[model samples]
Target: MENRRFDIRKSLLRALFASLCGVSANAMATEQYPCKPAPDEGRFAWGRIQSIDPNYLVKRILGPYTFKIPYGYMIGRPTPERLNCYPKQNRLEFAFWMPDFRAPKKDMWSEPNYRVHEPGRDAPGPQEYVVDVVGLEFIETKAGKSGSPGRRFVNGLALLRKDFRIEETYGLIHVVPGQNTPLSDDYVSLSNEGYEILLECSRPESRDSNPSCKAYLYFTDLQLEAVMQFPADALPEWQKIKDGVRILVERWIVKEKPT
Candidate 1:
């Protein structure tokens, strides 16, 4: 009887310990992103404007977002990072991660070996081009401007052309200028519904060297108020989504750095 009682006590203690561990993990996960820790939900606001670092840039909340560039830094852009409509709020608090420009040699960039497309999803089908973090900036409309025009950008995770498929999608991007060029006073509108970013691989201008692997970015915004510089390296499935615009991609951003 005493042994059974002791066993019951041990089981209860184990359950309690597990519960405590789970709670601790939950707390840590929530606290990780706050600019500062808070007992409850934390709020993020606009802060400082940071310069650009060629090596590094912004990363998604849970992303395998790492770049080939040697170094990088996050910048605080002008737009709000999170804009919610429940309360009809448009908060523009942008930020970025950049490299240490001062140390040139220390900043080394490398290109990873990735196929143009994944094994299962071949070309002709929808391809995905993901990045660590991408943003759209709105260029101001001048006096002569009229209705807004849009731009298009795309990033490809894998690009499969006629010949052998490119294993790792690198610098694979495509950009389509808006209907109205910079010459127009009124061009600026990433807010458009059709605006998108895509990723694909194409034969480089020169067949001699390594096939020109690129990341294509298309912006539907009339005036690109946002300027996004992607990391040279990315994960297999790193993606971004905008609920307002209703844009989705197969490529995705990983929650953590790649192995």
Candidate 2:
């Protein structure tokens, strides 16, 4: 395993950006971006926050969802250190564990020294990306611009791609442009850490005007299901993950396979 301290630039950049300017009361306006954490049921864009992190940017992808999040926060353990809350009502919870950003690829998710894993129905995917947390302004997620996140607000994505050592970028760690991208037929794929994670979305089959199922998320590692519904008291913390995935149908990339 590569030492976490191998990256010196990220630390230096954090120190440099911390002095630029503090967020003001006007920039803290709630109406700037109307982002209420509720399921739109189908595809849509999540609100954006102009976090003060210069090295970080908008646009993280997971399965059918693509939304802006604070940079440097990797797919953490299923237990979220920060945004952790839910009511008993048809609640949904999601957690992702990102692999160390540049661990050499050697089929760790399949034939590790301790265990031999299988992809089950889906094939193994590219290794995942991970990062450590320090001075992140991502916590102050305020109102953001509506509609598809424009390139201007999402400026940090390019920096991440240039600064980080990424391989086979997938899901939240891999920041792809646009919401809809071409994907494999399989909804599940393996990641770098030798664990099976849900990688794609298969539209639910239904003919009725209103389908019987509501969107729910699965924690691939724990094999736990969070059944979600729009309760009266649902908070942003509860609906963040579902909103990310639910919005994918409205917009996506649909990339072509390499020749």
Best-performing candidate as measured by TM-score: 1
> Against the true structure, what is each candidate's TM-score?
0.24, 0.17
Q: Report the Cα lDDT for residue 35, model 1.
A: 39
Query: What TM-score quantifies how close candidate 2 is to the native fold?
Result: 0.17
Clashes of each: 86, 14
Backbone clashes in model 2 = 14
Candidate 1 has its poorest 10 consecutive residues by lDDT at: 83-92
**Candidate 2 residue 237 C-alpha distance from true site, Å:** 30
Error of 2 at 129 (Å): 8.7
Taking all chains together, the TM-score of candidate 1 against the true structure is 0.24
Give the runs in model 2 whose Cα sits over 4 Å from its true position: 1-21, 25-32, 36-39, 45-98, 101-259
